[model samples]
Target: MSSKSEERREHTCISCGINISGTSAAKFDCPECGTLIYRCSKCRKQSNLYECPDCGFTGP
Candidate 1:
C-alpha cells in the first residue's frame, strides 16, 4: 500500500469555495470555468461535484 503522504491529494473547489484535501489522484475539471475540482472526501454524498447538467454554471 502507498504511504499516507502519497495517498493524500490536494485540490480546491470552485463553486463551493472550499479547500479540499485528501482527494483522489484522478480529478475533474469544471465544464464552465474549467476549474479543477479534486475528488473531496469531505463532500457529503457527493464526489467531484459538477456544474448543472443543462447549464455550465459554477456558482449559484
Candidate 2:
C-alpha cells in the first residue's frame, strides 16, 4: 500500500480549470511561490494564460 504522502494528488489545469491528472498535462512551478501548477495540452497549445493561485502571478 502507498503512504498518504506517496499518493498522487489530483491536479487541475490552471488555465481552463479542467482536471489534468491522468491526462497529458504540463506541470510547472509558480515562478513566485514554487507552487505546482498544471496546464492541459489544449490550453498549452493555445498559449492560454494562467494565474498562480498562490502568488497571483499571471502568464501565458
Best by TM-score: 2
Give the lDDT of residue 9 in candidate 1: 49
Error of 2 at 55 (Å): 0.8
Q: Model 1, range 1-60, lDDT digits (tens) per residue?
A: 868776564556543546666444336655676655453444434543546434566432
Ten-residue stretch with the least lDDT total in model 2: 2-11
Error of 2 at 57 (Å): 0.6
In candidate 1 the C-alpha lDDT for residue 35 amounts to 56
Per-candidate TM-score against the hidden true structure: 0.32, 0.81
- Candidate 2 lDDT, 1-60, residue by residue in tens: 868765477778999998887898888889889998899999999999999988899999
lDDT at 44, model 2: 94
lDDT for 21 in candidate 1 is: 60
Would you list the C-alpha lDDT of every candidate in the order shown? 0.51, 0.88
Q: Global lDDT for candidate 2?
A: 0.88
lDDT of 1 at 26: 37
